[model samples]
Target: MDNLQRIDYLLHTNALDEMGKNELISILLDEYGSKIVRLAYIYVKDQGKAEDIAQEVFLKCYEKLDQYRQEASIETWLSKIAINICRDYLRSGWFKYFARGVIDTFPYLKHKETPELKLIEQMENEKLMQAVFSLPQKYREVIILHYYMEYSTKQIGDLLAIKSVSVRSRLARAREKLQKKLETGEGS
Candidate 1:
């Protein structure tokens, strides 16, 4: 059988012992770790904390592998787990502290550049990212999932456990908010 089939059989048959589970988790992590980390970082706005949250999500997935119902693709299941973990992390008091700091920071740091025009471009990118990060969590989450992660509305809805209509509505709202912010230079 193929690798996915083997994983499906192992997961379904409850045959994954600790070592097997570790191997499976390793594979999944290797494939999805950067994406999860990026999602968490965008949500939390702190790289260190985002890494911690992503690790926790993977641990939960490993522990609960047998609980997967196979109603969705394994990637979808993993995305759901990651989103839930990020949401819970956002709701914590630590998130409040971090969020406040992130908002108050105003323009984010830009990469160093030798040419003046390149530096301006770097600063523009930083400003754009800061604006995105300043948006309300609901709007920011949908924007990040759709734009940054390049997830379609249906896929985002599945990962977020929301309806596709809800995802589309949120995406529209997020775009409006971002446009307004850009036009007025509010977050810049």
Candidate 2:
């Protein structure tokens, strides 16, 4: 069974013992941890803080698993939770005066290639990430979700709790800003 199906079965069967929790959390973190960190990084820009946010996302998920309505896919639900946590961090006072520059962009977590191929992929990813990190958070997130995460505008809207039209407008503006930055070599 899929993770969601397994989770649902566990909850329904009242089999949420230690083994079950471990298995569920393992599957979840294995499946979504890097995505959560990367998504959070799009907001906070600090890889360390993004990793913390990812852990918090999963913690909150486990706490609230019983309340999951399944209106969205498990990945979507986890992403929404991650987005909210990252947004909260961005709005917090700690991030205002203490924000650090982007230290490291999240590395791709899934490994499906030879060592040489992975190295080449990481090298390519590094160049693009520099430009992406320079964007304003509002524009950055829309760009990240659309291009990096490959979420549809409607899916992004749902995850961010915004209208799809708003997502499209933000994406348009982000693309314009990104192009200008790439051309000028400055985050204008």
Candidate 3:
């Protein structure tokens, strides 16, 4: 069944008490935790903040489970909430002042990964990461979702509530900017 169907069924059939809530939380976190944090990181670039935002997103989802109307896919709703939270974090003065320099954050951890593969995987150059991080929010979002997370334009559109055409256009523009920056060895 689709996530929307599963979510609707769960909401309608499950107990909403602490044990039930924890079970629901486990299910959601298992499905969405890393993806949600990665989505948040595309905006904030701070691992700690991304993780905090992910936690807040799940907490909000659990709290609002009883009220969810099943109008959209659960993933879509979670992505929207996470995107909004990340925006709030970006717009806050504290983020600009105290957290801007905190960008040397850890990449997302894969619990199943061997340390050998972790060490063997080629990392993005500092210049590349800087170029990506300097992009406007929309461009950054599309780039991360499309390139890093390997989401299709249609998937990105669904997650971002934009048309796939818009997602593709934004992605093209973002690619152009990244190429120009890479060619010049600086951010465009």
Candidate 4:
């Protein structure tokens, strides 16, 4: 079994004590911490807020362990929780009052051999990121979850509490919007 599957198995089949459950949570964090943070960042665009959202996601996971239905993978469940938390934060008055577009801090690209190539790639990536972030929230989430996180349409639907058809439609629309933005240098 994969790590998440194994974690799911242990969580359900074994009667882990408090310490064991904590250990499992630690493992989950190790496996998905950066990922969860990145996912949150895509929504909030703030590294600190994203980190906070990730912490909240894990805490919810720990509290809701017994409630998991296992119809979806543990990662999916965690992602759903994280998304919900992000939505909540987005709707908060605090976020509305203080929000500013922060450049993505994480380096998502690989280092190339030449400095020139690396610089070129970085600028391209920054432009692309800006374009993606400029999308409406619905489209942006679909793009990030589909392309960046590699979630299937059905999986994304489950996480977003929408139908798979909706996810596919959003993906198509998001791609079109992205294409226009990139070609026109809209967000540059």
TM-score comparison, 3 vs 4, better candidate = 4
Candidate 4 residues lying further than 4 Å off, grouped into runs, are: 1-6, 101-124
lDDT of 3 by residue, 1-188 (tens): 76545555666785678877777778788888888987776676556778899999999998887776667667777887898898888889987776654433533432224432232234566568678877888998898778777888887898788999999999999999999889888862
Top-TM-score candidate index: 4
Better of 2 and 3 by lDDT: 3
- Quantify all predictions' global Cα lDDT against the true fold: 0.77, 0.75, 0.76, 0.82
- Model 2, 2-62: lDDT tens digits are 8767766765676666777677778889878887887776676556678899999999988
User: Can you tell me which runs of candidate 1 are displaced by over 4 Å?
Assistant: 1-9, 12-14, 98-124
What TM value does model 3 have? Answer: 0.76
Winning model by lDDT: 4
Better of 1 and 3 by lDDT: 1
Please, what is the TM-score per model?
0.79, 0.72, 0.76, 0.81
Clashing pairs in 4: none
Worst 10 residues of 1 by lDDT: 108-117
Ranking by TM-score: 4, 1, 3, 2
Clashes of each: 0, 0, 0, 0
Q: Which stretches of candidate 3 lie over 4 Å from their true place?
A: 1-8, 12-19, 101-123
The total of clashing pairs for model 1 equals 0
| Candidate 3 positional error at 117, Å | 14
| Local accuracy of candidate 1 as per-residue lDDT tens digits, 1-188 | 65666666666766788888987888778777877877776665566777898899898898888788888877778878878887887788876786667555754432222243253255458667767878988888888788777899999888877899999999999989899998888776
